[model samples]
Target: MHTTTKTSPIETKDLVQKTVFPILFSISFAHLLNDLIQAIIPSVYPILKENYHLSFSEIGLITFAFQLTASLFQPFVGYYTDKYPQPFSQIYGMLFSLAGIIALSFADNFYMILISVMLIGTGSSIFHPESARVSYLASGGKRGLAQSIFQVGGNFGTALGPLLVALIVVPNSQKYILWFIIAAIIGLGIISKIAFWYRDHLVLRTNQKKEIVAYHDLSKGKVNWAIAILLIVIFSKFFYSACLSTYYTFYVIDKFHLTIKQAQFHMFIYLIAYAAGTILGGPLGDKIGRKYVIWFSVFGATPFALLLPYVSLFWTDVLMVVIGIIISSAFPAILVYAQELLPKKLGMVSGLFYGFAFGMGALGSAFLGKLADVTSIQYVYQVCSFLPIIGAICYFLPNLKKK
Candidate 1:
């Protein structure tokens, strides 16, 4: 007679430190690289507009192409990463990103520019699934803090990318594209070494068969109420993030009547505060639980966002820093929450929360821009304030518990 035995899930403390740490580091660094591309363009849009004589709609289309690719490709990548070895996917993605950056340097027409952006978007899409899956599997049960650290790296990149562009690319935009190519070459060398090391250490047992799962297997009725709640939270956060990413710099310059340098100073302060918030939010979520951290952030952020449109120039800068901290804090908590709700589907969950929410936010950007055109830009802030208020209300919904 044969008996089947069920294996228990691994304990959090029993996780391998070597595998966990490196996976986290790699994902975080990859995030930084991906975001560096995103950050540079917005800061230098004025330069691009002047050089190309582009319309606002044309610029919006460029952003739309970049975001739409990342958004739509996420599920496909998530499905494949689950069933395949992921190290090569990440390396290849970075290579594609590098190619895109190089292409951007020599892009003469709008079509070439859109092609470059699409390549970058394709590269970025690959990273979300591959890195996120590895990080979740490696982290065992201490997933929240682990995910947080990974996210903070991207936030740090988002903060630093603009500053780096300001210092380097702004002076000579064409020359900086070469810098991306050089960086790509260096990245290829590093990735090759890492891949070789990973392969050397890999142990495949003759007796053990690899398990392959389909996307439908992962998605069937595994939906938790917590996930639905978390999606709403993500939707709300994306609205604010879209405003900040696409229009905040422009808004600050126009609304407050400040020079470029003055607006940039405010942008830097807000970015720093945002980065700090992400860093702190993760550990706090792990300590206090995702529910509390998320709610607190939304509640805290709403008033500050409301105050943003009404304050004086100096006070608005201070208000933005405060609002940045509050909104940024909620993101890591949301990421962790979604991952927890879908442990077996980390890549899809992360992709849904991060990629979909971001895409939706990018879509929202066009709507907000139109709102800014018809109504006052201050009304955009009014719309921003409502998102968190709705998020906070949803956060308290009874269905949020695991069901």
Candidate 2:
């Protein structure tokens, strides 16, 4: 009887270390809905450009406005939430997105579109940091796998957006964006459930007075330098990604002489490959090392990206898929690596990385848009093809894995 009693605590501890897949998958589903609604913004950009008769520069500004709001407030939100966690905060984000969708569906002018996208971006800022925290909390020591599942949801959401837009909104008018509100409504319910679980989990954690600490041998200076290197890698990856996500549809249309719907379908294929890569990156990082995955994911795509500009139409599609998979794999590994670097500061670290990523994407979209206007979409690809070379710096990042 004494032995049974003594083993109970050890058993409980073991259970705590086991991955909580139900929570992980539930939160992932919520992430899917949240990002699906957010994806509506960029998915409809071509439509917005045509309807408003806007210039490429104006389209860039719209991306700038959306991503600026999305990027600027995330770190603060994460910082605040780190000190004072909010279980239901994602629900608030959903409401903002709902409002944004309604506003966007009716928007007849460029300024209105900007306002709508900003609102949606604000919701994104709130959703990501907190949701990432939730993933961390529920990870049960499988941090890489947890982050991958969380990220894959968002990637799938992002991929689905263009396909849905091509089917629903592309054939019709902009007012069809209202259909996205259904997703927002569904997200609210899922998030609320997750919030209840998070609240209970927090209470349990507080009661137990248990904390998780990840110790590494690296110095603070080395950690900071490593972080900077990761950010630079993020800048390279997303800057190049922005060229495709924001302008690839147009690029394909111009280069292949395809219709907008056909172009979106091509973009959908790339995004689907991106989602598939995201699925691979996280678990592979757990098995191998994040540094290795980061090194390969970014630099490995360089050859494909450099060749994409000169490829035939069929080859361009194939190259885009290859580049998407290779490059997209880096983010989950990079993010999980950062989280491991600053394990205690989960919210702040998550926010900072996500915020910086969005900032880079915004800058890339705006810069590439203007560049596309100045030269041509094909030229933008030629310039961006070199960005992935920046991944070679991954050599400097210290491996967090123990021997």
Candidate 3:
């Protein structure tokens, strides 16, 4: 008699609807669009190079333009988004990104492409801070899960970008630029509507109403260890980004002698693994501890990265996928760790983590590219393997106790 009634299982679908799904969906969609814009360029780089007779260094420079702009502006964007209540900043950022894509459609020379890439970077830069701030605020107790969802969106975008370009542009390469413009216009419409609706319904506290914390307050001695850890994370990210930017494309082409389309498909495997890792990593980090999760992830990636150059095409692809997953898993943990490191100054800490780390990584692309120029691309891959080892060492550094 006391056994009585059973409560209906909390409908997973219903819970998702009520909780974090919308935020995840919105951020994911935005990330997907942003990544798609960048993804197209790399996928079709071969075409661009052939058409324009561009050098490897020139191609590297073009890619740098996109990342440099995004990296440099990250702190400024993160600061203001945290301070400002208006959603229009994010919306306008999307609009500017679309404009950059549209401009790319008409680009006939390196300068024009550079301008377009810069515009796209400017637009893309705004999303991370604003979307991250929104996701964090919306997350309530489940910040790790929420961040994972946001990150998955980005991973999906990264995965899909090259695939999309391969499918659309590989056959009729001349039409690729036009397709980018069309996609931009469509994405802009969708983002504009959603942003306006979000602004209308959501009421936010003003900057005056919010308590302010200075950077110096958060950057004291206790947090220096955390900063050092984050620097290691940055180094790892640099290697990761460098590989994603250059080696992923080149490796497949060089090792297998595959066509652009074939190479892109293989790249998809790496991205798919990466996306899965990013999605799963955050929740796992919460379950265990962020520090432990990061340490394991960094350590796990090292073997796969080191072995990547020695394997055949099929096995190398498999190792790359595994490497992607391992690396991706560490990022959310790193982000959360940085946030915890400076609880009072979330915005500033986030700004430094997102801006400086990524910007420095973007700068690393040039360094890696030069290394590729001097030695071989395989050496670049081998050099990248050391980053995680360094990260692992930093993570285990006994003096750096978590505050």
Candidate 4:
């Protein structure tokens, strides 16, 4: 819903045009809670595979189902919220996540688990676009830093998932997943507060804060072409990520004969570095401009990624961290760039990019899993190592810097 205040741009600048740190941190913490719950699904894949006597292809399907559901709905959600602006949508999203996690805890068969994850994915679809819009609304002129604060929470939560699953779910039992209900309860409360903030802020803020005039100078065909190029960059980034996040644990376990728990620790280390990289990405984008960060973040990781497949275990751990940090920086920069590219369509842009990123990741995980079944997980890593080279297309993007 578009709320037109009588407040002029100059007046709005004085009254509400400053970054609201309280709102930013609160919503970001809620994002952390939401992703923490979502990450648990992949984090426990080993347990699911072992308990169900499933094949690698089944693991891929599970990811496909979850990510597909998550990705397909986001643009719709974002587009709707852009017009309708449902402040309490976050609460509803968390409630769905709660239900899905609870169902997942007791799921007995493959189909049931898939259905449960779909519900969880639905929750994510709703949560991300809405939270991202709120982050945009709260940005005040520091969109990059605000997005960084919001995104780092999610990466941190993602890093914690496998670590927590290893400590609690693996040693105890599958039912331990129910304990995350506590996280959901806390999330509900947090989102409720955020919803209140969103409701209050909606009327005060302008509909589209940042103007994307650069793309306007180009023809519509050129704008779409640039967007397609960015999507390719996203595909490269998330697909490579799918190879690592979903398969790295299995890879280390098979190669080094390390226990699953040990492998998860290495994944956690990679994810922690990933979180650190995300924090730096947005602020750097603000200071240096998104093009440089976007280009460097993805391709910059190439050397480490190439080295990873041939490395020893200790070196593997070190390389994974380096790769994680560099690759993880791409998203925040990529996202804010897309939002700027289509400033009037902020929700649509956010949803489309976020949705496509998840969808590509799903395809990557499923396709790589099938490839692993045909060849080997080690070979999958070797193949995916070349994805970052796709970042070279970043050279084709026009400079978006203002004169």
Question: Which candidate leads in TM-score?
Answer: 2
Question: Mind giving the per-residue lDDT tens digits that candidate 3 earns over 196-298?
Answer: 6446334322212332222334446757766786667677766566666555777678767888889888888888898899987788877877777777777
The sequence of per-residue lDDT tens digits that candidate 1 reaches over residues 245-349 is 766777787787876545666677788888788877877877767778888887678777777777788897788778888788887777766665555576677
Error of 3 at 202 (Å): 6.0
What TM-score would you give candidate 4 relative to the actual structure? 0.94
The parts of candidate 1 lying over 4 Å away from their true place are 1-19, 186-222, 375-379, 397-403
* Full-model lDDT for every candidate: 0.67, 0.89, 0.69, 0.88
Worst 10 residues of 3 by lDDT: 205-214
- Tell me each candidate's TM-score: 0.84, 0.96, 0.86, 0.94
Of models 1 and 3, which has the larger lDDT? 3
lDDT, candidate 4, 1-403, per-residue tens? 9996576666655546668899899988888888899899889999999999988899999999999988999999989987888999888888889999999999999999999899998999999998998888788867788899999999998998899999989999999999899889999999998888888776555543743233446677877877998999999999999999989889999999989789889889999999999998998888888888899999899888888899899999889888888988888888888887787787888889989999998999899989999999999999999999999888887666554
Give the higher-lDDT candidate: 3 or 4.
Answer: 4
How far out, in Å, is residue 339 in model 4? Answer: 0.7
Worst 10 residues of 1 by lDDT: 205-214
After superposition on all CA atoms, what RMSD does each candidate show versus the true structure? 6.0, 3.2, 7.0, 3.3
Shift of residue 320 alpha carbon in model 4, Å? 0.8
By lDDT: ranked, best first = 2, 4, 3, 1
| Candidate 2 Cα RMSD after full superposition onto the native fold (Å) | 3.2
Query: Pairs clashing in candidate 4?
Result: 1-83
lDDT by residue for model 2 over 251-301, one digit each (tens)? 999988999899889989999999999999999999899999999999999
lDDT agreement of model 4 with the native? 0.88
